[model samples]
Target: MSDSRQFQVALSLLPYVGAKTAKTLVSYCGSAEEVFSAPSSRLLKAPNVGQRIIKSIKENKSQALEEANKQLSIAEREDVKILIYTDKGYPKRLLRHEDSPYILYYKGNADLNAQKTVGIVGTRKATEYGKAMTQKIVRDLTRYNPLIISGLAYGIDIFSHKASLECGLDTVGVMANGLDKIYPPAHKNTAFDMIDQGGLLTEGCFGTMPDPSRFPQRNRVIAGLSDVLIVVEAAKKGGALITANIANYYNCEVFAVPGNLEAMASEGCNKLIRNHQAHIYTSVEDIEYILKWDLDERTTKPIKKSVGQLTMEEQIIMNKLEEDGGTMAIDSLSIKTQIPLGQLASQLLMMEMKGIVKALPGKQFKVVH
Candidate 1:
């Protein structure tokens, strides 16, 4: 790591500093480097900066920087990416939440910012029914080609990851522990496969153990990373419920697969639906409807077609798409082209048949590139 960047890592090591406070310090000092360089009086001027925090900063300076340097070296040697919040590779979704991790240790080939992401979480003691549903859901969702996300725990979490792998989809396992070791130990092989097929992500750095208190915090990371979270199965209270509650707070769609009333595993899911915290997940179609994943949605190289080859409406749609930078939501296209919804749907369908356009998630369309 660069000398200047190590200071950013050092900020996380300060005794009282957390993500929000570190950001505040940076905003006050103008940069991470300045935060360290500014004297105590100057640091005091920053909002929430007081005698205690300034003292912590002053006392911990050398040790924090040294530890940060060691962290950087270990990350480099292990092929792990240490992404501070400001880095381009950091998960943008997490940025919207105040409690998002300030840094992440990622080691994988999968795109952290995949076009679509789905988080599946549930009871650690999964039932056979839960396993079946997870497998089926992943298989059906394969058409949309979304990245599957789970906690890498047993039962539904592991089922979700395994299903994703079997379907040839990338799956990221958010860890409660550090990248240095897999918690639960049994999930190690699957975690290893995910490193090649998907990824393992955590805010915990090297040598950090998976303490019990960190699991709830880890669930927040899973919720933050997902576009939507599915609770395949959960008892009345568990980490899955915690994740669901967090996802709801983020206003991301949450789906709860319905299970029989007699089943203990269904209680939490049923409660979420009953309380309107989540939609009742009946099938993949439920997901398709809310997310607007059109069956024909895709991106492809645009074929050269003459204006003469298109009907007037097709030409109009093409012109609108071009004006909109080659992509537009269905509603946007309708208003832009001044076409009625039914007519526009028909026109887009015809266009898809001719390879002039493709469907995308959320009813968006893009001209074949």
Candidate 2:
């Protein structure tokens, strides 16, 4: 890669140099090359340069250089792009965060920065409602063509990526480890699709597998990149909640889809809504309403309705289907409306016969208009 890029990556490996300290160092010495060449005495005089840091720099300079070189070699081998905080291509939204990484290793489409970003997060052990809601809301949001950002963990995270891809939306999966491998290897296929579709992102260097400790560290990046963070479902404690907390810290709008009060999977969502940590979103309209994102223009052309009337139950089901952009499952509608399954089936059949709705493979019903 570029010498300038190498110097910047080298700076990341310097003893005690973090994002904030690196900024000061670059400002003090004028460039990464200058900082490397500057005398210890001169470096100590730089703003916020502590004597301990200076001593580490002086004593470990060779070791630090070796480490940096190793990392660069690995990155070159993998064809990964390393973006320093100072790079123009570094995501601007992330740069605004207080603890943004000094350097990040990324692979796949670099054009992910070209689109608006939205985060979809929630519990790993998702419920049916959570799964359906995540899928439905993301399907609606994809019409806007926003980039999807989420941790690569299972449950809601995978669902988010899957739904986004299905709708032809580019998606970025933030990993808690290096891009050299996928975490929860079950998501390998999804991860592969994401590399070409959007990308994989992480601040951790090459060969660093995602340890438990790194995930909480990883959540901030997800929060920083997106303009809005939506928690589809969560328990009282889960990575999604941590991501939501980080998003709130970044001043990004936090949204939680309202869930059943009695469901174990929804406890965290209920808490978020109750404590005002997140706005209540039962549908995409709630998200658009709070963010003032216009859905009218982004929404797909409404399917045409035939010149026919409908029975009372069929009419109610049709309206619900319309509200969801013509996608609703029988079980979900039955639960939502407190209608018996047998009755709901009769209504769906009547609606389907009238051409008011169409039945999908997944037992999902969609309104024609």
Candidate 3:
């Protein structure tokens, strides 16, 4: 890496030098190298700089360099890529936010500067309603090529990533920890796959473990990277709420899928709607209406079947199969797509009888082209 890159890494490690502070320092000093080369007196003149921060900057310079080089070694071993704020490829939406990070570590194929980005977030312990909403919104959003952004936690986050992958949409999973490790080890496999299909992004440097305090801070990044934030479900309190709040602060459109009021998972979403903090979405059409984004002609085509032609369950299964490839294995597709196997079998039989799908050998099924 060049001197500029090294300076960015150094600045990020400073105790009180957060994204906003770094931006101010860099803006005043002309560049990260210039900031580093500036005297302590001159550095303290920058906004939000405290005496303690100034002392740490002067005293921690050597230690910061050693740690930065170590972080680079770790990043190299993991094949993770780092981007500084000045780098052309750093996410444009995030940079436009009030306090975007100066350095980001990412691993994936997604373009950070994707055309339209939407965030899907919710509680960890999700309801069936939340799962269904997540699947529906993600499948619809994929038709427009919007980059899906979310934390890689359980419930809505994982559901969004899985659905986006199923629909072949690019996604970005933001983390609260260093890129060197995944916080929730259960998501290790999903994180690995995202590197090839989507991406894992973070503002934290190497060797930093996920601390509880970092999550709320991490939520800002999720909100900043997105043009719109959709809360699939949430309890009365959770990280999703934090992201939604940040989205509001950023003046981005915040949306929530309504759920049964009796369910615990719907509490936060209901509150958001009741308090007028978020717009409610019944379908992707509602989101499109609010954001004024044109829907793809392919996705907007009405299902051509008559009401009497297919049962409600069959219609849903057919829609999923169509959004995906029309051909899918009866079992794996049932699991991944969240359709009940018995219902799916019945639906397939009805479709087959109606000439909508043809049954293949070994229990496989393919829709009639």
Best-first order by TM-score:
1, 3, 2
Model 2 — which ten-residue stretch has the worst lDDT? 295-304
Across 1-369, the per-residue lDDT of candidate 3 in tens digits comes to: 666677778888988777888888889889877877888889878888778877877888888877888877778888888888888988877764667888899888999888788999999998787888888898888768999999999889998998888889988899999887896899898888888888999998887789999998889999988878999999999899999999887767899878888989899999999999999878888877765565323343323455467767776667666776776557755876687888777877777666676654224466665
Better of 2 and 3 by lDDT: 3
- Candidate 2's TM-score reads 0.76
lDDT of 1 at 250: 71
**Candidate 1 regions with alpha-carbon error over 4 angstroms:** 295-369
Choose 2 or 3, whichever is better by TM-score: 3
How much RMSD separates candidate 2 from the native structure?
15.2
lDDT of 1 by residue, 1-369 (tens): 588789988998889987788888887898888999998888888887788899889899999999999989999999999988889999977876778887799999999999889999999999999999999999999988998999999899999999999899999999988899998899999999999999999988788899989898899989888878999999999999999999887767899999999899999999999999999998889987776665436454556666789898898999999997898778778988999999999989888878788776435678974
lDDT of 2 at 238: 82
**Which parts of model 3 are misplaced by more than 4 Å?**
295-369
Least accurate 10 contiguous residues by lDDT in model 1: 293-302
TM-score, every prediction: 0.81, 0.76, 0.78
Clashes of each: 2, 1, 0
Best by TM-score: 1
Please identify model 2 stretches exceeding 4 Å from their true place.
295-369
Clashing pairs in 1: 297-359, 302-369
Query: C-alpha displacement of 139 in model 2, angstroms?
Result: 0.5
